[model samples]
Target: MPRAAIDVISVYVRKAQKQRSRLPSFRSLAALEAVVRHGNIVWAADELGVTPGAVSKQLGSLEEELEAPLFHDGHRLRPTPVAIELAQTLGVALHLLREGWDKATHGLDTGVVTITGNASLCMHWLVPRVLAMQAAAGGRAIRVTSLHTSDTWWQSTVDIAILRHRRVPVGWESQTIGTERLTLLGSPERARRAAERGIAALGGETFLAAETRHGDLDRWLAAAGVGADTERRDSVHFYVAIEAALEDMGMVVAPIALCHDLIAQKRLAAPFPACTIRGAGLAGAYNRAICSPRTAESLFRWMKREMRRCSILPAV
Candidate 1:
Protein backbone atom coordinates (compact mmCIF):
# COMPACT_ATOMS: atom_id res chain seq x y z
CA MET A 1 0.00 0.00 0.00
CA PRO A 2 1.07 3.61 -0.54
CA ARG A 3 2.39 5.35 2.61
CA ALA A 4 -0.32 8.07 2.64
CA ALA A 5 -3.11 5.54 2.14
CA ILE A 6 -1.77 3.40 4.99
CA ASP A 7 -1.70 6.44 7.34
CA VAL A 8 -5.31 7.36 6.51
CA ILE A 9 -6.42 3.76 7.21
CA SER A 10 -4.69 3.84 10.66
CA VAL A 11 -6.45 7.13 11.54
CA TYR A 12 -9.86 5.66 10.63
CA VAL A 13 -9.21 2.56 12.74
CA ARG A 14 -8.31 4.71 15.82
CA LYS A 15 -11.45 6.79 15.46
CA ALA A 16 -13.56 3.67 15.25
CA GLN A 17 -11.93 2.22 18.38
CA LYS A 18 -12.74 5.37 20.35
CA GLN A 19 -16.45 5.23 19.50
CA ARG A 20 -16.71 1.52 20.34
CA SER A 21 -15.43 1.82 23.89
CA ARG A 22 -18.25 2.34 26.42
CA LEU A 23 -18.77 3.28 30.09
CA PRO A 24 -20.90 1.73 32.94
CA SER A 25 -24.53 0.70 33.31
CA PHE A 26 -27.39 2.47 35.17
CA ARG A 27 -26.84 0.24 38.21
CA SER A 28 -23.31 1.61 38.60
CA LEU A 29 -24.57 5.14 39.16
CA ALA A 30 -26.10 3.96 42.42
CA ALA A 31 -22.74 2.54 43.46
CA LEU A 32 -21.05 5.85 42.63
CA GLU A 33 -23.46 7.75 44.88
CA ALA A 34 -23.00 5.21 47.66
CA VAL A 35 -19.24 5.53 47.45
CA VAL A 36 -19.31 9.32 47.50
CA ARG A 37 -21.65 9.45 50.48
CA HIS A 38 -19.81 6.81 52.50
CA GLY A 39 -16.26 8.13 51.81
CA ASN A 40 -14.57 5.13 50.23
CA ILE A 41 -15.15 2.26 47.91
CA VAL A 42 -14.28 -0.16 50.70
CA TRP A 43 -16.76 1.51 53.04
CA ALA A 44 -19.31 1.68 50.25
CA ALA A 45 -18.76 -2.00 49.58
CA ASP A 46 -19.02 -2.75 53.28
CA GLU A 47 -22.25 -0.80 53.52
CA LEU A 48 -23.63 -2.55 50.47
CA GLY A 49 -22.10 -5.84 51.68
CA VAL A 50 -20.33 -6.21 48.35
CA THR A 51 -16.66 -6.53 47.49
CA PRO A 52 -14.45 -3.49 47.09
CA GLY A 53 -13.44 -4.69 43.66
CA ALA A 54 -17.05 -4.80 42.65
CA VAL A 55 -17.51 -1.23 43.83
CA SER A 56 -14.43 -0.20 41.92
CA LYS A 57 -15.70 -1.79 38.73
CA GLN A 58 -19.05 -0.09 39.10
CA LEU A 59 -17.29 3.22 39.63
CA GLY A 60 -15.18 2.62 36.54
CA SER A 61 -18.35 1.88 34.65
CA LEU A 62 -19.92 5.15 35.78
CA GLU A 63 -16.85 7.12 34.75
CA GLU A 64 -16.95 5.53 31.35
CA GLU A 65 -20.63 6.28 30.96
CA LEU A 66 -20.13 9.89 31.90
CA GLU A 67 -16.95 10.23 29.83
CA ALA A 68 -15.38 11.95 32.81
CA PRO A 69 -14.20 11.02 36.27
CA LEU A 70 -16.90 11.19 38.93
CA PHE A 71 -14.66 11.61 41.95
CA HIS A 72 -11.11 12.92 42.22
CA ASP A 73 -10.79 14.05 45.81
CA GLY A 74 -8.27 13.03 48.47
CA HIS A 75 -10.77 11.83 51.11
CA ARG A 76 -10.61 8.46 49.32
CA LEU A 77 -14.33 8.35 48.60
CA ARG A 78 -15.56 11.94 48.62
CA PRO A 79 -17.24 13.35 45.52
CA THR A 80 -15.56 15.48 42.92
CA PRO A 81 -17.35 18.51 41.49
CA VAL A 82 -18.73 16.30 38.78
CA ALA A 83 -19.91 13.78 41.28
CA ILE A 84 -21.46 16.42 43.53
CA GLU A 85 -23.20 18.02 40.58
CA LEU A 86 -24.40 14.67 39.36
CA ALA A 87 -25.58 13.66 42.81
CA GLN A 88 -27.39 16.92 43.35
CA THR A 89 -29.21 16.45 40.07
CA LEU A 90 -29.89 12.73 39.97
CA GLY A 91 -30.19 11.54 43.58
CA VAL A 92 -33.83 12.25 44.43
CA ALA A 93 -35.71 11.21 41.33
CA LEU A 94 -33.68 8.04 41.00
CA HIS A 95 -34.33 6.84 44.53
CA LEU A 96 -37.99 7.71 44.31
CA LEU A 97 -38.28 5.88 41.04
CA ARG A 98 -36.56 2.82 42.45
CA GLU A 99 -38.80 2.78 45.49
CA GLY A 100 -41.89 3.20 43.37
CA TRP A 101 -40.84 0.44 41.02
CA ASP A 102 -39.99 -1.87 43.90
CA LYS A 103 -43.38 -1.37 45.47
CA ALA A 104 -45.16 -1.90 42.17
CA THR A 105 -43.24 -5.02 41.12
CA HIS A 106 -41.82 -6.55 44.31
CA GLY A 107 -44.60 -6.58 46.91
CA LEU A 108 -43.10 -3.62 48.81
CA ASP A 109 -45.23 -2.00 51.45
CA THR A 110 -46.33 1.60 51.72
CA GLY A 111 -47.64 1.02 55.22
CA VAL A 112 -44.67 2.14 57.29
CA VAL A 113 -41.93 4.73 56.77
CA THR A 114 -39.25 4.86 59.47
CA ILE A 115 -37.30 8.11 59.88
CA THR A 116 -34.21 8.70 62.02
CA GLY A 117 -32.99 11.93 63.62
CA ASN A 118 -31.59 13.29 66.87
CA ALA A 119 -33.68 11.52 69.54
CA SER A 120 -34.80 14.36 71.78
CA LEU A 121 -35.48 16.68 68.90
CA CYS A 122 -37.54 14.04 67.15
CA MET A 123 -39.48 13.24 70.29
CA HIS A 124 -40.09 16.83 71.31
CA TRP A 125 -40.15 18.75 68.06
CA LEU A 126 -41.02 16.19 65.39
CA VAL A 127 -43.03 13.35 66.93
CA PRO A 128 -46.25 15.18 67.72
CA ARG A 129 -47.10 15.47 64.03
CA VAL A 130 -46.68 11.84 62.99
CA LEU A 131 -50.38 11.25 62.91
CA ALA A 132 -51.05 14.23 60.69
CA MET A 133 -48.48 12.95 58.20
CA GLN A 134 -49.99 9.46 58.32
CA ALA A 135 -53.41 10.90 57.72
CA ALA A 136 -52.19 12.94 54.79
CA ALA A 137 -50.25 10.04 53.29
CA GLY A 138 -52.95 7.38 53.34
CA GLY A 139 -52.37 6.15 56.87
CA ARG A 140 -48.65 5.51 56.43
CA ALA A 141 -46.69 4.98 59.64
CA ILE A 142 -43.88 7.42 60.34
CA ARG A 143 -41.45 6.03 62.93
CA VAL A 144 -39.06 8.52 64.41
CA THR A 145 -35.56 7.67 65.60
CA SER A 146 -34.12 10.30 67.85
CA LEU A 147 -30.53 11.07 68.89
CA HIS A 148 -29.15 10.13 65.53
CA THR A 149 -26.25 12.22 64.18
CA SER A 150 -24.74 9.57 62.03
CA ASP A 151 -26.13 7.06 59.55
CA THR A 152 -27.22 4.43 62.07
CA TRP A 153 -29.98 3.66 59.60
CA TRP A 154 -27.34 2.01 57.43
CA GLN A 155 -27.72 -1.17 59.45
CA SER A 156 -31.48 -1.20 59.28
CA THR A 157 -34.04 -0.88 56.52
CA VAL A 158 -35.25 2.70 56.47
CA ASP A 159 -37.47 4.76 54.20
CA ILE A 160 -36.20 8.27 54.86
CA ALA A 161 -33.74 10.40 56.84
CA ILE A 162 -34.58 13.75 58.45
CA LEU A 163 -32.25 15.94 60.49
CA ARG A 164 -30.81 19.41 61.18
CA HIS A 165 -28.30 21.05 58.90
CA ARG A 166 -26.77 24.49 58.56
CA ARG A 167 -27.74 24.60 54.92
CA VAL A 168 -29.95 22.62 52.58
CA PRO A 169 -27.59 20.57 50.43
CA VAL A 170 -27.28 21.51 46.77
CA GLY A 171 -28.59 18.17 45.55
CA TRP A 172 -31.56 17.93 47.90
CA GLU A 173 -34.68 20.06 48.25
CA SER A 174 -35.67 21.16 51.77
CA GLN A 175 -38.35 23.02 53.65
CA THR A 176 -37.34 25.63 56.20
CA ILE A 177 -38.82 25.15 59.63
CA GLY A 178 -37.64 28.32 61.31
CA THR A 179 -34.35 29.86 62.26
CA GLU A 180 -32.64 30.12 65.65
CA ARG A 181 -29.44 31.48 67.13
CA LEU A 182 -26.66 29.75 69.05
CA THR A 183 -26.02 30.60 72.68
CA LEU A 184 -23.36 29.69 75.17
CA LEU A 185 -25.90 27.96 77.40
CA GLY A 186 -25.20 27.43 81.08
CA SER A 187 -26.72 27.80 84.52
CA PRO A 188 -28.35 31.24 84.28
CA GLU A 189 -26.88 32.29 87.59
CA ARG A 190 -23.40 31.15 86.57
CA ALA A 191 -23.59 32.81 83.15
CA ARG A 192 -24.84 36.07 84.64
CA ARG A 193 -22.06 36.04 87.18
CA ALA A 194 -19.55 35.20 84.49
CA ALA A 195 -20.94 38.02 82.36
CA GLU A 196 -20.52 40.52 85.18
CA ARG A 197 -16.78 40.17 85.11
CA GLY A 198 -15.93 39.67 81.41
CA ILE A 199 -16.88 37.38 78.51
CA ALA A 200 -13.66 35.37 78.60
CA ALA A 201 -13.89 35.10 82.40
CA LEU A 202 -15.79 31.87 81.91
CA GLY A 203 -12.78 30.46 80.06
CA GLY A 204 -12.39 27.80 82.67
CA GLU A 205 -16.03 26.68 82.47
CA THR A 206 -16.78 23.06 81.65
CA PHE A 207 -17.48 22.32 78.01
CA LEU A 208 -19.42 19.72 76.04
CA ALA A 209 -19.29 18.91 72.31
CA ALA A 210 -21.23 16.66 69.96
CA GLU A 211 -19.62 13.62 68.36
CA THR A 212 -20.21 14.50 64.71
CA ARG A 213 -21.66 17.95 65.08
CA HIS A 214 -21.96 20.49 62.30
CA GLY A 215 -20.80 24.00 63.23
CA ASP A 216 -21.59 23.62 66.94
CA LEU A 217 -18.40 25.27 68.20
CA ASP A 218 -17.82 27.55 65.23
CA ARG A 219 -21.31 29.04 65.39
CA TRP A 220 -20.94 29.43 69.15
CA LEU A 221 -17.55 31.05 68.82
CA ALA A 222 -18.54 33.18 65.89
CA ALA A 223 -21.64 34.27 67.76
CA ALA A 224 -19.80 35.49 70.87
CA GLY A 225 -16.24 35.14 69.68
CA VAL A 226 -15.86 32.57 72.48
CA GLY A 227 -12.38 32.54 73.94
CA ALA A 228 -13.25 31.19 77.33
CA ASP A 229 -11.34 28.14 78.44
CA THR A 230 -12.95 25.46 80.60
CA GLU A 231 -11.01 24.13 83.59
CA ARG A 232 -12.86 20.78 83.87
CA ARG A 233 -14.99 18.87 81.38
CA ASP A 234 -16.36 15.58 80.10
CA SER A 235 -17.02 14.43 76.51
CA VAL A 236 -20.41 12.91 76.84
CA HIS A 237 -22.70 12.28 73.89
CA PHE A 238 -24.18 15.55 72.55
CA TYR A 239 -27.71 14.94 73.79
CA VAL A 240 -26.54 13.92 77.24
CA ALA A 241 -24.24 16.90 77.43
CA ILE A 242 -27.01 19.28 76.45
CA GLU A 243 -29.40 17.68 78.91
CA ALA A 244 -26.90 18.06 81.71
CA ALA A 245 -26.17 21.67 80.80
CA LEU A 246 -29.86 22.49 80.70
CA GLU A 247 -30.18 21.28 84.28
CA ASP A 248 -27.97 24.26 85.22
CA MET A 249 -25.01 22.06 86.07
CA GLY A 250 -22.39 23.19 83.51
CA MET A 251 -21.81 24.93 80.17
CA VAL A 252 -22.72 23.98 76.61
CA VAL A 253 -22.64 25.74 73.28
CA ALA A 254 -25.60 24.79 71.07
CA PRO A 255 -28.05 26.18 68.58
CA ILE A 256 -30.89 27.94 70.29
CA ALA A 257 -33.38 25.95 68.25
CA LEU A 258 -32.35 22.79 70.05
CA CYS A 259 -32.78 24.49 73.43
CA HIS A 260 -35.41 27.13 72.69
CA ASP A 261 -38.35 25.72 74.69
CA LEU A 262 -36.20 24.96 77.69
CA ILE A 263 -34.58 28.37 77.51
CA ALA A 264 -37.95 30.13 77.33
CA GLN A 265 -39.16 28.02 80.25
CA LYS A 266 -36.10 29.20 82.21
CA ARG A 267 -34.58 25.74 82.24
CA LEU A 268 -31.59 27.05 80.26
CA ALA A 269 -30.33 30.58 79.61
CA ALA A 270 -28.14 32.31 77.10
CA PRO A 271 -24.66 32.99 78.37
CA PHE A 272 -24.33 35.60 75.66
CA PRO A 273 -26.83 37.81 73.89
CA ALA A 274 -29.26 36.16 71.42
CA CYS A 275 -28.17 38.22 68.40
CA THR A 276 -24.69 36.77 68.34
CA ILE A 277 -25.49 33.40 66.71
CA ARG A 278 -26.54 35.04 63.33
CA GLY A 279 -29.62 32.82 63.69
CA ALA A 280 -29.99 31.49 60.15
CA GLY A 281 -31.51 28.22 61.32
CA LEU A 282 -31.87 24.63 60.14
CA ALA A 283 -34.55 23.01 57.95
CA GLY A 284 -35.70 19.46 57.16
CA ALA A 285 -34.23 18.07 53.91
CA TYR A 286 -35.50 14.94 52.24
CA ASN A 287 -32.72 13.22 50.32
CA ARG A 288 -35.04 12.50 47.45
CA ALA A 289 -31.97 12.21 45.31
CA ILE A 290 -30.99 9.06 47.14
CA CYS A 291 -34.41 7.46 47.43
CA SER A 292 -36.60 6.24 44.52
CA PRO A 293 -39.86 4.98 45.95
CA ARG A 294 -43.17 6.55 44.90
CA THR A 295 -44.52 5.60 48.30
CA ALA A 296 -41.42 7.00 49.98
CA GLU A 297 -41.64 10.10 47.80
CA SER A 298 -45.29 10.31 48.74
CA LEU A 299 -44.29 9.81 52.35
CA PHE A 300 -41.46 12.36 52.17
CA ARG A 301 -43.71 15.08 50.75
CA TRP A 302 -46.47 14.17 53.17
CA MET A 303 -44.03 14.35 56.06
CA LYS A 304 -42.66 17.72 54.96
CA ARG A 305 -46.15 19.15 54.81
CA GLU A 306 -47.09 17.57 58.10
CA MET A 307 -43.93 19.03 59.60
CA ARG A 308 -44.90 22.44 58.33
CA ARG A 309 -48.51 22.07 59.51
CA CYS A 310 -47.48 20.73 62.92
CA SER A 311 -44.56 23.16 63.08
CA ILE A 312 -42.11 20.34 63.65
CA LEU A 313 -39.31 21.82 61.54
CA PRO A 314 -39.20 24.85 63.80
CA ALA A 315 -40.66 24.82 67.31
CA VAL A 316 -42.27 28.22 66.57
Candidate 2:
Protein backbone atom coordinates (compact mmCIF):
# COMPACT_ATOMS: atom_id res chain seq x y z
CA MET A 1 0.00 0.00 0.00
CA PRO A 2 1.07 3.56 -0.60
CA ARG A 3 1.31 6.27 2.06
CA ALA A 4 -1.69 8.14 0.73
CA ALA A 5 -3.84 5.00 0.79
CA ILE A 6 -2.75 4.30 4.36
CA ASP A 7 -3.71 7.84 5.35
CA VAL A 8 -7.10 7.41 3.70
CA ILE A 9 -7.64 4.16 5.59
CA SER A 10 -6.61 5.76 8.87
CA VAL A 11 -9.03 8.63 8.37
CA TYR A 12 -11.80 6.18 7.50
CA VAL A 13 -11.07 4.16 10.64
CA ARG A 14 -11.17 7.26 12.84
CA LYS A 15 -14.53 8.27 11.38
CA ALA A 16 -15.93 4.77 11.77
CA GLN A 17 -14.80 4.72 15.40
CA LYS A 18 -16.53 8.02 16.07
CA GLN A 19 -19.85 6.79 14.62
CA ARG A 20 -19.93 3.15 15.66
CA SER A 21 -23.73 2.87 15.16
CA ARG A 22 -23.43 4.11 11.55
CA LEU A 23 -20.83 1.60 10.49
CA PRO A 24 -21.97 -0.45 7.49
CA SER A 25 -22.65 -4.17 7.80
CA PHE A 26 -19.68 -6.49 7.25
CA ARG A 27 -21.52 -8.42 4.54
CA SER A 28 -22.34 -5.20 2.69
CA LEU A 29 -18.76 -4.00 2.98
CA ALA A 30 -17.50 -7.35 1.72
CA ALA A 31 -19.81 -7.11 -1.27
CA LEU A 32 -18.66 -3.58 -2.05
CA GLU A 33 -15.03 -4.55 -1.69
CA ALA A 34 -15.39 -7.57 -3.94
CA VAL A 35 -17.40 -5.70 -6.56
CA VAL A 36 -14.95 -2.80 -6.62
CA ARG A 37 -11.88 -5.00 -6.61
CA HIS A 38 -13.07 -7.26 -9.42
CA GLY A 39 -15.15 -4.60 -11.27
CA ASN A 40 -17.88 -7.18 -11.93
CA ILE A 41 -20.98 -7.94 -9.85
CA VAL A 42 -21.25 -11.51 -11.13
CA TRP A 43 -17.66 -12.27 -10.22
CA ALA A 44 -18.05 -10.74 -6.79
CA ALA A 45 -21.28 -12.72 -6.26
CA ASP A 46 -19.53 -15.93 -7.30
CA GLU A 47 -16.66 -15.19 -4.92
CA LEU A 48 -19.10 -14.47 -2.07
CA GLY A 49 -21.19 -17.59 -2.95
CA VAL A 50 -24.28 -15.62 -3.86
CA THR A 51 -26.16 -14.40 -6.91
CA PRO A 52 -25.67 -11.11 -8.77
CA GLY A 53 -29.04 -9.82 -7.45
CA ALA A 54 -27.94 -10.48 -3.88
CA VAL A 55 -24.69 -8.65 -4.51
CA SER A 56 -26.57 -5.73 -6.02
CA LYS A 57 -28.86 -5.57 -3.01
CA GLN A 58 -25.86 -5.58 -0.71
CA LEU A 59 -24.32 -2.71 -2.68
CA GLY A 60 -27.57 -0.76 -2.44
CA SER A 61 -27.61 -1.27 1.32
CA LEU A 62 -24.01 -0.11 1.57
CA GLU A 63 -24.71 2.99 -0.52
CA GLU A 64 -27.72 3.87 1.64
CA GLU A 65 -25.63 3.41 4.80
CA LEU A 66 -22.77 5.53 3.46
CA GLU A 67 -25.24 8.11 1.98
CA ALA A 68 -23.08 8.31 -1.12
CA PRO A 69 -23.48 7.11 -4.67
CA LEU A 70 -20.71 4.55 -5.26
CA PHE A 71 -21.46 3.45 -8.80
CA HIS A 72 -22.60 5.13 -12.00
CA ASP A 73 -25.13 3.40 -14.25
CA GLY A 74 -23.52 2.67 -17.62
CA HIS A 75 -22.78 -0.19 -19.99
CA ARG A 76 -20.80 -1.58 -17.06
CA LEU A 77 -20.91 -0.54 -13.43
CA ARG A 78 -18.24 2.12 -13.11
CA PRO A 79 -17.15 2.79 -9.57
CA THR A 80 -16.91 6.38 -8.46
CA PRO A 81 -13.59 7.74 -7.19
CA VAL A 82 -14.76 7.48 -3.61
CA ALA A 83 -15.83 3.89 -4.12
CA ILE A 84 -12.45 3.00 -5.62
CA GLU A 85 -10.54 4.48 -2.71
CA LEU A 86 -12.87 2.89 -0.18
CA ALA A 87 -12.47 -0.49 -1.83
CA GLN A 88 -8.69 -0.16 -1.75
CA THR A 89 -8.78 0.67 1.95
CA LEU A 90 -11.16 -2.18 2.65
CA GLY A 91 -8.95 -4.57 0.74
CA VAL A 92 -5.91 -3.60 2.78
CA ALA A 93 -7.80 -3.93 6.02
CA LEU A 94 -9.18 -7.35 5.13
CA HIS A 95 -5.73 -8.52 4.03
CA LEU A 96 -4.24 -7.38 7.31
CA LEU A 97 -6.99 -9.18 9.23
CA ARG A 98 -6.33 -12.37 7.32
CA GLU A 99 -2.59 -12.04 7.89
CA GLY A 100 -3.21 -11.62 11.61
CA TRP A 101 -5.44 -14.68 11.73
CA ASP A 102 -2.90 -16.73 9.80
CA LYS A 103 -0.12 -15.59 12.08
CA ALA A 104 -2.16 -16.47 15.14
CA THR A 105 -3.04 -19.94 13.83
CA HIS A 106 0.33 -20.78 12.31
CA GLY A 107 3.79 -19.67 13.34
CA LEU A 108 5.49 -16.75 11.60
CA ASP A 109 8.13 -18.80 9.85
CA THR A 110 6.39 -21.22 7.48
CA GLY A 111 9.74 -22.57 6.06
CA VAL A 112 8.53 -21.72 2.60
CA VAL A 113 9.16 -18.51 0.69
CA THR A 114 6.95 -17.51 -2.23
CA ILE A 115 8.30 -15.33 -5.03
CA THR A 116 6.25 -13.76 -7.82
CA GLY A 117 6.98 -11.87 -11.00
CA ASN A 118 5.78 -11.45 -14.59
CA ALA A 119 4.93 -14.52 -16.64
CA SER A 120 7.87 -14.08 -19.00
CA LEU A 121 10.43 -13.64 -16.27
CA CYS A 122 9.04 -16.55 -14.29
CA MET A 123 8.99 -18.85 -17.29
CA HIS A 124 12.25 -17.88 -18.99
CA TRP A 125 14.46 -16.91 -16.06
CA LEU A 126 13.23 -17.83 -12.58
CA VAL A 127 11.53 -21.22 -13.00
CA PRO A 128 14.58 -22.88 -14.48
CA ARG A 129 16.73 -21.70 -11.53
CA VAL A 130 14.28 -22.58 -8.74
CA LEU A 131 16.39 -25.47 -7.48
CA ALA A 132 19.50 -23.31 -7.24
CA MET A 133 17.51 -20.61 -5.43
CA GLN A 134 16.15 -23.19 -2.98
CA ALA A 135 19.66 -24.45 -2.29
CA ALA A 136 20.77 -20.88 -1.69
CA ALA A 137 17.94 -20.52 0.82
CA GLY A 138 19.42 -23.44 2.84
CA GLY A 139 16.83 -26.07 1.75
CA ARG A 140 13.74 -23.99 2.48
CA ALA A 141 11.01 -24.66 -0.05
CA ILE A 142 10.69 -21.94 -2.70
CA ARG A 143 7.43 -21.27 -4.48
CA VAL A 144 7.29 -19.21 -7.67
CA THR A 145 4.10 -17.73 -9.10
CA SER A 146 3.52 -15.75 -12.26
CA LEU A 147 1.57 -12.62 -11.48
CA HIS A 148 1.06 -10.12 -14.29
CA THR A 149 -0.47 -7.20 -12.42
CA SER A 150 0.91 -5.07 -9.59
CA ASP A 151 -2.44 -4.03 -8.15
CA THR A 152 -3.06 -7.41 -6.46
CA TRP A 153 -0.06 -7.32 -4.14
CA TRP A 154 -2.22 -7.12 -1.03
CA GLN A 155 -4.30 -10.10 -2.11
CA SER A 156 -1.26 -12.35 -2.60
CA THR A 157 0.73 -14.34 -0.04
CA VAL A 158 3.99 -13.97 -1.92
CA ASP A 159 7.04 -13.32 0.20
CA ILE A 160 9.15 -11.62 -2.44
CA ALA A 161 8.25 -9.98 -5.74
CA ILE A 162 10.61 -9.34 -8.63
CA LEU A 163 9.16 -6.37 -10.49
CA ARG A 164 10.35 -3.90 -13.11
CA HIS A 165 10.08 -0.93 -10.81
CA ARG A 166 12.58 1.64 -9.59
CA ARG A 167 10.64 2.82 -6.54
CA VAL A 168 9.58 0.76 -3.54
CA PRO A 169 6.02 0.94 -2.26
CA VAL A 170 5.28 2.25 1.24
CA GLY A 171 5.82 -0.29 4.09
CA TRP A 172 7.89 -2.57 1.85
CA GLU A 173 11.61 -3.09 1.28
CA SER A 174 13.14 -3.19 -2.20
CA GLN A 175 16.56 -3.44 -3.81
CA THR A 176 17.60 -2.96 -7.42
CA ILE A 177 18.64 -6.30 -8.87
CA GLY A 178 19.85 -5.06 -12.28
CA THR A 179 18.95 -3.03 -15.33
CA GLU A 180 17.45 -5.21 -18.05
CA ARG A 181 19.31 -4.98 -21.34
CA LEU A 182 17.06 -5.28 -24.37
CA THR A 183 18.57 -6.82 -27.47
CA LEU A 184 17.24 -7.62 -30.92
CA LEU A 185 17.02 -11.36 -31.43
CA GLY A 186 15.97 -13.54 -34.35
CA SER A 187 16.66 -16.91 -35.96
CA PRO A 188 20.20 -17.55 -37.21
CA GLU A 189 19.35 -16.95 -40.86
CA ARG A 190 17.50 -13.68 -40.24
CA ALA A 191 20.16 -12.56 -37.76
CA ARG A 192 22.96 -13.33 -40.22
CA ARG A 193 21.13 -11.33 -42.92
CA ALA A 194 20.60 -8.38 -40.57
CA ALA A 195 24.22 -8.53 -39.44
CA GLU A 196 25.42 -8.35 -43.01
CA ARG A 197 23.12 -5.48 -43.94
CA GLY A 198 23.70 -3.51 -40.73
CA ILE A 199 20.99 -1.58 -38.87
CA ALA A 200 19.05 -0.59 -41.97
CA ALA A 201 18.01 -4.18 -42.54
CA LEU A 202 15.82 -3.91 -39.44
CA GLY A 203 13.46 -1.64 -41.43
CA GLY A 204 13.03 -4.30 -44.11
CA GLU A 205 12.13 -7.16 -41.75
CA THR A 206 9.03 -7.57 -39.62
CA PHE A 207 9.54 -6.75 -35.93
CA LEU A 208 7.87 -8.96 -33.37
CA ALA A 209 6.81 -7.16 -30.17
CA ALA A 210 4.84 -7.99 -27.04
CA GLU A 211 1.78 -6.07 -25.99
CA THR A 212 3.39 -5.79 -22.56
CA ARG A 213 6.36 -4.04 -24.16
CA HIS A 214 4.66 -2.15 -26.95
CA GLY A 215 7.20 0.67 -27.12
CA ASP A 216 10.37 -1.44 -27.04
CA LEU A 217 10.72 -1.72 -30.80
CA ASP A 218 10.54 2.03 -31.39
CA ARG A 219 12.81 2.69 -28.43
CA TRP A 220 15.41 0.21 -29.72
CA LEU A 221 15.18 1.56 -33.24
CA ALA A 222 15.67 5.13 -32.00
CA ALA A 223 18.66 4.05 -29.91
CA ALA A 224 20.15 2.37 -32.95
CA GLY A 225 19.63 5.58 -35.07
CA VAL A 226 17.22 3.88 -37.46
CA GLY A 227 14.21 5.99 -38.48
CA ALA A 228 12.55 3.87 -41.12
CA ASP A 229 9.09 2.47 -40.42
CA THR A 230 8.96 -1.32 -40.09
CA GLU A 231 6.23 -3.94 -40.08
CA ARG A 232 5.48 -5.21 -36.59
CA ARG A 233 3.51 -8.10 -35.11
CA ASP A 234 2.39 -8.12 -31.51
CA SER A 235 2.10 -10.97 -29.03
CA VAL A 236 0.63 -11.03 -25.54
CA HIS A 237 3.87 -11.87 -23.78
CA PHE A 238 7.59 -11.38 -24.37
CA TYR A 239 8.24 -15.11 -24.22
CA VAL A 240 5.65 -15.58 -26.94
CA ALA A 241 7.27 -12.91 -29.08
CA ILE A 242 10.66 -14.56 -28.61
CA GLU A 243 9.13 -17.89 -29.48
CA ALA A 244 7.71 -16.43 -32.64
CA ALA A 245 11.14 -15.05 -33.49
CA LEU A 246 12.59 -18.51 -32.98
CA GLU A 247 10.16 -19.85 -35.59
CA ASP A 248 11.60 -17.18 -37.95
CA MET A 249 8.38 -15.16 -37.91
CA GLY A 250 10.07 -11.85 -37.14
CA MET A 251 12.74 -10.14 -35.06
CA VAL A 252 12.05 -9.36 -31.40
CA VAL A 253 13.49 -6.90 -28.94
CA ALA A 254 13.64 -8.65 -25.56
CA PRO A 255 15.51 -8.68 -22.29
CA ILE A 256 18.83 -10.45 -22.63
CA ALA A 257 18.40 -12.32 -19.34
CA LEU A 258 15.38 -14.13 -20.79
CA CYS A 259 17.07 -15.13 -24.05
CA HIS A 260 20.77 -15.47 -23.20
CA ASP A 261 20.60 -19.25 -22.98
CA LEU A 262 19.09 -19.49 -26.47
CA ILE A 263 21.66 -17.05 -27.77
CA ALA A 264 24.47 -19.13 -26.24
CA GLN A 265 23.02 -22.32 -27.72
CA LYS A 266 22.90 -20.71 -31.18
CA ARG A 267 19.12 -21.11 -31.28
CA LEU A 268 18.79 -17.31 -31.29
CA ALA A 269 21.07 -14.59 -32.53
CA ALA A 270 21.76 -11.04 -31.42
CA PRO A 271 22.13 -9.27 -34.72
CA PHE A 272 23.42 -5.92 -33.45
CA PRO A 273 24.95 -6.30 -30.03
CA ALA A 274 26.10 -2.66 -30.02
CA CYS A 275 22.51 -1.48 -30.42
CA THR A 276 21.23 -2.98 -27.17
CA ILE A 277 18.95 -0.63 -25.24
CA ARG A 278 18.70 -0.32 -21.48
CA GLY A 279 15.27 -1.41 -20.35
CA ALA A 280 13.61 -0.90 -16.96
CA GLY A 281 15.58 -1.75 -13.82
CA LEU A 282 14.50 -4.93 -12.03
CA ALA A 283 13.77 -4.61 -8.31
CA GLY A 284 13.25 -7.26 -5.66
CA ALA A 285 10.59 -6.15 -3.19
CA TYR A 286 9.31 -7.82 -0.02
CA ASN A 287 6.98 -6.81 2.75
CA ARG A 288 8.81 -6.92 6.08
CA ALA A 289 5.66 -8.01 7.91
CA ILE A 290 5.52 -11.27 5.95
CA CYS A 291 9.14 -12.04 5.01
CA SER A 292 11.95 -12.27 7.54
CA PRO A 293 14.89 -9.94 6.94
CA ARG A 294 17.37 -12.80 6.65
CA THR A 295 15.28 -14.67 4.10
CA ALA A 296 14.67 -11.57 2.00
CA GLU A 297 18.34 -10.62 2.00
CA SER A 298 19.43 -14.15 1.05
CA LEU A 299 16.98 -14.30 -1.87
CA PHE A 300 17.96 -10.83 -3.06
CA ARG A 301 21.62 -11.80 -3.07
CA TRP A 302 20.86 -15.01 -4.94
CA MET A 303 18.85 -13.11 -7.57
CA LYS A 304 21.65 -10.62 -8.08
CA ARG A 305 24.24 -13.36 -8.46
CA GLU A 306 22.11 -15.34 -10.90
CA MET A 307 21.36 -12.23 -12.97
CA ARG A 308 25.05 -11.42 -13.17
CA ARG A 309 25.69 -14.84 -14.70
CA CYS A 310 23.50 -14.08 -17.74
CA SER A 311 25.67 -12.72 -20.54
CA ILE A 312 24.57 -11.89 -24.08
CA LEU A 313 26.79 -12.48 -27.05
CA PRO A 314 26.21 -12.91 -30.77
CA ALA A 315 25.47 -16.47 -31.79
CA VAL A 316 28.51 -18.30 -33.20
RMSD of each: 20.7, 20.8
The sequence of per-residue lDDT tens digits that candidate 2 reaches over residues 1-316 is 7767676556666766766745778888899899998889999999999999999998998776665688987788899877888888889889998889888555435578899888888887888889988888777789888976545764667788898874556678999998888888899899999999998656778989987887888999999887748788887777788789989999998888877778878888888888888888899999877787777888899888778778456346
Consecutive 10-residue window with the lowest summed lDDT within model 1: 307-316
The per-prediction tally of clashing pairs is 26, 0
In terms of lDDT, the best-performing candidate is: 2
Best candidate (score: TM-score): 2
TM accuracy, model 1: 0.47
Regions more than 4 Å wrong, model 1: 1-110, 128-139, 147-152, 163-180, 188-200, 278-316
lDDT of 1 by residue, 26-92 (tens): 5576777777777677887887778999988888866665556777656555566667655544466
TM-score of each: 0.47, 0.63
Candidate 2 residues lying further than 4 Å off, grouped into runs, are 1-110, 166-170, 311-316
